[model samples]
Target: MEAEACKKCGYTEFKKGKLGNGYVNLMPINSFFSSGSPMIVTFCGHCGEVSSVSVEKPRKF
Candidate 1:
């Protein structure tokens, strides 16, 4: 998904930030063992602002 506008600078263009991943920490002690999907981080090229959003839809607890 692409961001429509940057909240801070209203910039319409964004660049995909450094490759990032997502993980679930069901328990603090097992944080390292859990696995999940990748996360998308977008940066506003005009103002250096950034946004991190999960690519997957919300999940029920």
Candidate 2:
């Protein structure tokens, strides 16, 4: 969605970075964990605004 125009500044380009899988939280102190899929980092090259898109698709009704 924001790949074309930046949601912050309307830039037509972005920088993409890879994220990891073990993206879960193993902190026992917080007692929270995530066993979900991977994700991507998309940021506006011009305005430095960032957004995330998950590899998993949205659930259907």
What tens digits encode model 1's per-residue C-alpha lDDT throughout 1-61?
8759989989898887434334432223435544434455678889979865544422311
TM-score quality measure for candidate 1: 0.47
Global lDDT of model 1: 0.58
RMSD of each: 5.5, 6.1
The residue-by-residue lDDT of candidate 2 on 1-61, one tens digit each, is 4347887888887887556546531223433443544456777778878866545422310
- Model 2: residues with Cα > 4 Å off, grouped in runs: 1-3, 21-38, 56-61
For model 2 the local lDDT of residue 38 reads 45
**Clash number by candidate, in order:** 0, 0
lDDT of each: 0.58, 0.58
